[model samples]
Target: RRPRRSAGPVSEAESGGSQGVGAPLGVMSALEKQLHLGRLPPRPPLPGGGGQSGSKMRMGPGRKRDFSPVLWSQYFESMEDVVVENETGKDTFRIYKSGLEGPVLLLLHGGGHSALSWAVFTSAIINRIQCRIVALDLRGHGETKVRNPEDLSAETMAKDVGNVVEALYGDLPPPIMLIGHSMGGAIAVHTAVANLVPSLLGLCMIDVVEGTAMDALNSMQNFLRSRPKTFKSLENAIEWSVKSGQIRNLESARVSMVGQVKQCEGAASPECPKAIVEGIIEEEEEDEEDEEGGGSVNKRKKEDDTETKKEHLYTWRIELAKTEKYWDGWFRGLSNLFLSCPTPKLLLLAGVDRLDKDLTIGQMQGKFQMQVLPQCGHAVHEDAPDKVAEAVATFLIRHRFTEPIGGFQCVFPAC
Candidate 1:
């Protein structure tokens, strides 16, 4: 069904929240049937080399598709290294910023994804409305360096969000909207609950509903295992990410893939970016975090991933499998937290079925705006950035969070 268009909250019928709750397929519920958790990417074709034994990966658009990684500067105005001092120590968190004025859209990417993941969404949103973007590479993911990267507990990350905001603006900050996707969405809710961002005017969560997320957790490991372990080159990673449906948008994948992988130790290709290829030691030490979480240490797998990494030119920046222990924590009580947020709210999902009981009830009572964008994957912002941007821009404009830039208009009714 097409996404419902309105100036108000989504109706129950349109939300599809009335679907049967039981598992028609024994263990898989009707809701989980639509969930695409960690999509297992097929092995990418290595130039003349084959991908898998039965290679069927489709080629990208154009006669000659370029899979090269794009620089962050192509999308963001500037990148900052905010040094946040706390009881633990001084931690440097990397943030990418854009736009000159108006309210700030503080973006938090999902677990295992980087701030760069928001590159496409940032451009689309800015064009539709007057706003700024501050996309942070969370503690464990991307370029954010923290003393304790393994502490993905809700409390720690919520505190990190507060610390970064405080570090950026001492006491008074601009009117800010906490917009997050997947794990980031949960963090945004927790941040709101903690009253971390005093200037927070709105909250938007993309494609992360507690009910579906919890059910999908049981199959997360299978999804992780099915992914391609390594790429022969940087371009290989981007191509695989797109063709494998990991990220549907090509332009988004080009810029975002670089943040998800790093040059493989002892196997750096000539095409590997200089910055990534040179930080072998720092990255390796970062890997030590897996042990602390007990997710890859005495309590977790002992597989020889080191051998496999050596066989490739590039490998995943974070082995998400090790961080499995924190999965429940990321989403537990997320619904209540999101609903409890007093700020104006928006929930953007890839499918109407994603709406859980709590959120559906809240929407009926007009607690927040819910937009269902079907046909896209879980990475809703990346898959359909224009639609996501339009939905968000309209929500902001309706509430007068910020004035529209030239050539933009608000047609949707105010909530």
Candidate 2:
């Protein structure tokens, strides 16, 4: 008979002893030493140019480059931009292009993020699929300018996407596959449900839930409420970010994304503008206080609560509020819309760092196949670029409308 084991808890020392002597010390010693102290040679500063090399540098990591023609040559060949007007007359859609011939992929970014977020993925897709990729900077974000306040709504944003698509590739068959993150994902769903574009091969939603403006507002309220106290200066903010491990392991491109959020001059300076920083601090405090105190208020009231509202309106907050209205309508009509469309869809659900799991579950039940990326956070593409790339490639290959001449018919071609 097997010896009866005591149902007792194990202590750390006992556990360590069981692993053999000196294991803890060896582990500690190894961790104490830096692994890459002098392993990597310094990279040379990139050369200046307006074409592909510059664009490649701008695009940053996890992006593919063809070396046959050289990095610079390929980069130059892939760089182009066009300005398309939003149908709602609220924004100018700045469309950046990569890849020459192939199917079209429209990449839309999430709230507080720009099309530049897709730069790495765009580069990879362009090289791998021989497909044209267009990344659009939505209104009030990145280089895109919002022309009208009304155009900020979700429906209008979806309309803007349709307009830009028609304007750029109307002549061509709808060689478009929609990939959207966060807010962009919502817009993509809206566009699909509305049947704004013909022949949408697939829709990929990255980390967004189906909902209305109220949901967005609630999300923002929760986010603001959970934030640490605002800093007195910009340097302090950066320092805090660095110390908190937020910016420590981030790539240069990711750092650049944060840099774009710096609004005031001398933000990098030690003597940063107190007024600007204070305004941010005050707004966050007010938001937290209001939400906690059960004060039901709209954007105008929230703005009025801040002393520097006229001078330093948080563009992010305003944009969020505008999006909330659209989300409200979307949430109400989501079921009917999903039933009506039933288009093949890919939903990349992050396994970590998300507040709502039900949203993802609901999507899965609504005929959206979910790929739960283990150990990934809200920014699935950024956190796991290789995995994302693989998934994207597989998706494209599976649903590819255009067949390659004299090429493999299936991913798993029969022997």
lDDT of each: 0.80, 0.54
Model 2 scores worst on lDDT over the 10 consecutive residues at 67-76
Candidate number of the best lDDT: 1
Candidate 2, which segments miss by more than 4 Å at Cα?
A: 1-81, 85-91, 211-219, 225-249, 252-262, 265-273, 276-324, 330-339, 352-366, 402-415
| lDDT value, residue 129 of candidate 2 | 56
Model 2 error, position 123 (Å): 2.9
**Clashing pairs in model 1, backbone N/Cα/C closer than 3 A:** none
Tens digit of lDDT per residue, candidate 1, span 174-247?
89999999999999998999999999999999999999999999999999977776665678788788767888
TM-score against native, each model: 0.75, 0.59
List model 2 lDDT by residue over 1-415, tens digit each.
Answer: 2232343555667447443322322233344323422333554565543543123333443443221111222222343444565444434566667766777778888776666566656655555555777878776676665666445566778877887777776756656788888778777888887777786888887766544323556677566444333343333443343333332213313422432243333334332333333222223334466778755445544454454422322122123444454556545554345435566777676752342445545554655555667765556665565566556666677666443332323332111
Colliding residue pairs in candidate 2: 52-75, 52-76, 90-147, 90-148, 212-327, 212-328, 213-324, 213-327, 213-328
Backbone clash total for model 2 is 9
Give per-residue lDDT, candidate 2, residue 415: 13
